[model samples]
Target: MTKIFIIAGEASGDVLGYRLMTALRALRPGLEFSGIGGARMAEAGLVSLFPMQELALMGLAEILPRVLHLKARLRQTVQAIAAQKPDIVLTIDSPGFTLRVLKAVGANGPKRVHYVAPQVWAWRQERVKHFPGLWDELICLLPFEPDFFAPHGLHPVFAGHPVLESGADKGDAARFLARHRLGPEAVPVVLMPGSRVTETKRLLPVFRETLALLAPHVPNLAPVLAAAPGIADAVAAYTANWPHKPVIVRDVQERYDAFAAARAALTKSGTSTLELAMAGVPMAVTYQVNPVSAWFGRRLIKVPHVAMINLLAKRALVPELLQEQCHPEILAATLLHLLRDDEAAAAQRAGYAEALASLHAPEGTPSHAAAKAVLSVLG
Candidate 1:
């Protein structure tokens, strides 16, 4: 039996890892999987070494205090994978934790594969040079990512964007709206703070404040908050005191339906932006970080825009309010512009159409593509 060790440190990565594992199982039924992941991966037969949350810390500043703990976890993961002697060690997103663990595993000359290539295209292009020595195969979700790695002597295969298959169920939308007591004429605004507690704490207040500001101008503004799997209680507590009650939906199917029906969205900057684009929802992105970390990021990052919509378009297709600019007034203004202006909304939708086309897989499913890359390296 062929054994594979897979590590995915957060919610999105967990989802992606599970899908890939499922695809690999289809291709090779006797494959064995073991490593660190969340509920989804566990359901897909991954025996996690530790709870995925231990390695799911966000932002440089948020992770600073936990560095020692994270280092210990990475060392433990490396040792576990090394002892298992899997045919291939596949590390998913969470570059901070995954890369450090990869370095340790690679030092011993282990066969390894890296999924979802880091945003070397955005900044730190130099890091591409190190992958050839660290990972035997690179499987990327974005089409352009492979070209970036090619120059560095690493041949990367483009796996389709995992979000392409995350289609929303129309029937679920009506049922969810009825269950939440949302009227048919109500224009719902979806608020997706983030999948982690730290991001929820940092972003929910600003999102709430933005809704408060937009309430009078856009009456019948029904806001629905999607509670990320692990942090439902945290999200509920954060919204408990809000002047306006927002319906919290937990099911992924219903959440996507909410995205499909939403008039507009105010989301944290990440894969959610890609999802919003996939749903053709006009949105404004906002993000905040600790003061020191923000200052450091400003100096080191070279990207012109933070939102994936803008990055993929090679221009500002969606407004990104980051750090100081992530104030409620600014977010409301940007969202209002998108919601109220028909022409602007149409233009943004066109950009979304283009982004969607760019993400389509050429030959096979992304998970299948990724599994093939892993197997090739293992052989």
Candidate 2:
């Protein structure tokens, strides 16, 4: 029997971890999986050693109060790895918890693979020194990451962006439109406020105003919202007063269906952009954080672009409206341009193709490529 210990913290990591587990199992049957993960990974048979939320804390402020609890969980995770003595130890993201556990396991432990290399290139270049000794195999999602790490005396496998495996393009748009009772004249617009509560709180009001502004121009406009499960109710509350009520989809399948039905998308500047790009939806990215955070981020961020698609394309493939530029008027105008201009939309889709092609693995899908990389540890 083959055994592997895997740990994933936070929702995104959980999704990636589940996909990797599914791919690993497809390649090798009857494999044993044990470690920490959320509900998604549990579907793939990872009974988490502790609540994944324990390590899901994002900022230092959140983690400081739970230091003792996290320390104990860390010890427990270290002990579990020692007891299982699995063929491989796989850690996905959550540099706070996963990296510590990997470090504690030491170089003498079973072959270790750390997926989603930390974005040291973005801000924390100094953190790169500690990472060289952490993982036997480093699996990065971005195409540029292997180049970034190789120069630092570390070899990494670019497994392609996980968003490619999202099944975003496989949605039944006709069925989705029919189910929503949208007619041929109706134009479906996808609204991705964000997956986090803070983001939804900031963006939904602006999104509502954007919709109100575009309604007269876009005939029979239909809004489809892609919201995270935790923030769904909040999204509902925020959008209750909007003129055109959005059909909010909580999970991936529903969101993908909505994406397929969409003529254009208004999304925050993140992975949601990639999701829209994968579904061939023309979009404008918008983001507004607290004044101070935005101000600091402007200085700290090394990259020129905010949208991942643009970053990957090495050009302004999509419009990014940030901070003061993220007003309802700007977002509304940006979205209206996408809905009205066929040539501009076509150009964005072409760039989407170019950007997404960079995410293709040397063979098969990204998940399969990642699985092959992880399995290489044994042979």
Candidate 3:
């Protein structure tokens, strides 16, 4: 039996890996699978070595103290995969963990495939040099990444952004408004602090404060908080004291519906920024990492913009307040500008539409393309 080992350490990577697994199963039935992934990947038949959430962490400073624990887990995972002798080792995102494990496994000369290209385009461009020798192929979600990898002697395939296939719900916005007990005429403002505990802890307080500031001016506004699964309790606890009591939605589909109904959004800068852009929701992106990590990142990272919406547009299409700039008052002012200023909001929405179009795949779906690439490596 052909065996494939895949590793995806966080929520986004888990979703990507799961979709790829489903596509691979359709292409090649009876393929064996094992890996490190989350609930979604487990549902897709991935046998995880550890609970996926165990590795879902962010910020270099936050991760520094846990290095020994992570190293032991990596060794355990690599040894298990080596013993299984999979035909190909496929890793999705989570570069810090995935790439290190890939290097350890590559030492034994196993074929390797990496999905969801790291943000080498943003910073640490030198990391691109490590891929050609570490992995057989790299599958990227962004179109511009292949060119970035070409000059570095690495073959990179643009698999297209997976969010396009998410098939956002297009039902009546009024229905979503009604179901959430909101007035039909109310302008919805969605708040997505983040899907991780670390992100929510760092950003929710600022989001709540922003909401407080905007509540009075935008009387017709109803804030919708999209809480990612497994972090719902944390999100709820964080917002329990807020005076406005924002509406909270849990399911991913429901969250997309919230986006569809939203006139504006205040979101943490990440993949969700890409989703919001696709939904054509004008937004203000904010992010806050550990103070020390933020300090170090500012010195090392070369990118001028942090939000994926602005990064993909190759300009400041959406307002981004990151690190020290992620103050609640600034976030409030940026969000209010989008909510109240028609011209500015329309311009941002138009830019988002263009950025969304730029991400569409040339042929087939990204999941299919990624699966095909993995199968080729397995062969």
Off by over 4 Å in 2: 53-76
Q: Give per-model TM-scores.
A: 0.95, 0.90, 0.95
TM-score of 1: 0.95
Whole-model lDDT for model 2 versus the true structure?
0.86
Model 2, C-alpha of 275: deviation from truth (Å): 2.1
Q: How displaced is residue 322 in candidate 3, in Å? A: 1.1
Clashing pairs in 3: none
- Tens digit of per-residue lDDT, candidate 3, span 1-379: 7788889988888888889989999999988899898878888877789888878889887788889999899999989987999888899999999999888887466689989888977877777777777788889888888998878766788878888877553535666787888877788999988877788888888877888898888988798998877688878887888887888888777878888899999888888898887777888888889988877777778788888878788899988888888987888888888888999988988898777777766678879888888888777
**Residue lDDT tens for model 2, 94-166:** 8888899999999998989999988878875777888888888899889889888987776699888778888
The Cα error of candidate 1 at residue 303, in Å, is 2.1
Error of 3 at 311 (Å): 1.9
Task: Kindly give the stretch of ten consecutive residues in candidate 1 with the minimal lDDT sum.
Answer: 167-176
Whole-model lDDT, candidate 1?
0.83
User: CA lDDT, every prediction?
Assistant: 0.83, 0.86, 0.84
